[model samples]
Target: MATLRRYDLDWLRVIAILAVYLHHVGMPFNGDDFHIMNTDSSKLLDDMMVFFEQFRLPLLFLISGTGTIFAFSKRTWIQFTKERAVRLLVPLFFGVLIIVPPQTYFEHINEYASYFEVYKNADFGINHLWFIENLFWISLAVIPLILFLKSSKSNRLLCFFEQITAKKFGVFFGVLPLILILISSKKYFPSDSKDILNLSSTFYYGFFFVMGILFASAEGTWIHLKQFRKLNAVLFIISTIVFYAYYFMPSEWISPYLTINQRWNLWYIVCCLVGWTFVTTLLGYAQIWFNKKSVLVQKLNEAIYPFYILHQTVLIVLAYYIIQFELNIPLKMLLLLVTSFPIIILIYRFLVYPFKITRVLFGMKKRV
Candidate 1:
């Protein structure tokens, strides 16, 4: 049977999604081309943004993969797929149709065009809900492998992962494939564009998803994580500090030791390292610290999906007018940040959760 509720994983999911929210809120002030823009931008903010960019989504995907193992253990293939579709797809479709348009509309509303005209154009796209769209498709694509791994013949392959991860050095092998795939992806597919409906970043995230399945199937995986928590934490910090050196250090200071391409290759490898270490470390430490259930986590865990779907739209729409207030960047960013959480919470509590039709459409379970 699948194990009892894992609150550590719940904690990880909540933290990762909140990081995503903060990232989106900060993106505008960093001078990036986002749905909204600030009048003045900061290189400091830009550097901070790049730092979080390294592991934020990768960590999220890894956690999803870990959770998938437990989720699959309890359900047959038919039930699993049905639940996945309802939980992931329903929100993506609903958000795309109802929630996403406002963000795009705000983007173009000040650009000499009507909201209807902007909404009519396909160029507006799905906005932040791309993660949901991509994940749903990936879940569908991996069904055959998920089934095969559950069979008898694949016992050896499953045993191999379990044995390797159980060893002191086995974690190295677990992380090696991820490092290689990340390096190869950067070297070959240098395009940094995102088209959510396409398999643009599939090879990248698929590796993590598969790793998650393997990790969860292995007995005592959480035990291994806890055993090596300190080591992973040290490596995570050192790698991150060095990763920042590449940006903060003067180019002339390090150019003699490494060329630009060499520097970037090294940086990309560290990105994978930091991402890997962070996920493992968080898994380890969270299990140690956050395994208990509580009302706060319970409420946040239940609300996380809808919060993610609604947060960006709320922020963007609010920001559309907040930017025009002649406030400083920090104040503007702060106002949007403070206003967003309460509004999203209130909406979910009253507008989305209470209605059965809205709940199902928003990817919540229907009321009894």
Candidate 2:
């Protein structure tokens, strides 16, 4: 059978990576302690980043999960595992060793004698490549489940989801498992930590990964998503508002009735809702608008993985210098954005695109 091509997913992947680039560009000014920080920070940018945080990584993971189905459809489990190891691990190792050290060097320049010193230490962890690392492991972890779902045994499981998605509001039920997973385990695991060892964060993202598989497994799910796009949009808006309102709400203003733990769990539940609604809303709308193919989309889809790998290190290096200039936050951000984007693309086009070795190191399929 010929593999199905999802133009909408291709479009979403490109858009998500671009959003990630923009988010990183805003990081220095967003009042967060990133690898580098600006002298002055913006509360507005901070608030915007906070809002985006609820759903950004979740969307990527879900899309990755969906992509996994397509990937696995073309290969046996062993082949799929090897492909993932090559596609994910090789780049992760390259990023940690080659690409990520510059960010660390710039971050703590005074502490290190030279970039080579930082590289020699090899203590720079995965940095932004954490996503790639998590994805590789999650891909391996889900193989058994994916295989089961592919077998005759999972027919009833797929059928159950199909029936639910057939209802007007049934697609929304997908969020319930995620909410429960988060609310119950968040206290122990603290979903905010990016450490792969952090069970809360793993489960939180893993649920989305699993959901992506289910969405791909159940053919009717996309129809429900598109059908309820409007409703999901409204809910996304409402949930975002509620999430922010709760975020900005003073602790002193809270009712004495709600315990601190209860309040925390409530916040987790709200976050799950916002994340689910945001993802479903975008998926639904993308189905309608981005399902058609484009030459640009195809190009972007090919470059996006390398772009993501290169973006943060480049952004951090540029921002380290850009932040020193006597410019306002917006101008600095604009300068960094304008300069780094093309530089990343050029590096990919000239350095990473043509060569088989560079292509493999950066997680692209080695061209013949």
Top TM-score hit: 2
lDDT of 2 by residue, 136-220 (tens): 9999999999999889998999888888887876877788999888887787876477878998899899999999999888887
List the candidate 2 regions with Cα displacement exceeding 4 Å.
none
RMSD of each: 2.3, 1.4
Best by lDDT: 2
User: Each model's TM-score?
Assistant: 0.92, 0.97
| Residue ranges of candidate 1 with Cα displaced over 4 Å | 122-124, 196-200, 253-261
Q: Give the Cα lDDT of each candidate.
A: 0.79, 0.89
TM-score, prediction 2? 0.97
Candidate 2 lDDT (Cα, 0 to 1): 0.89
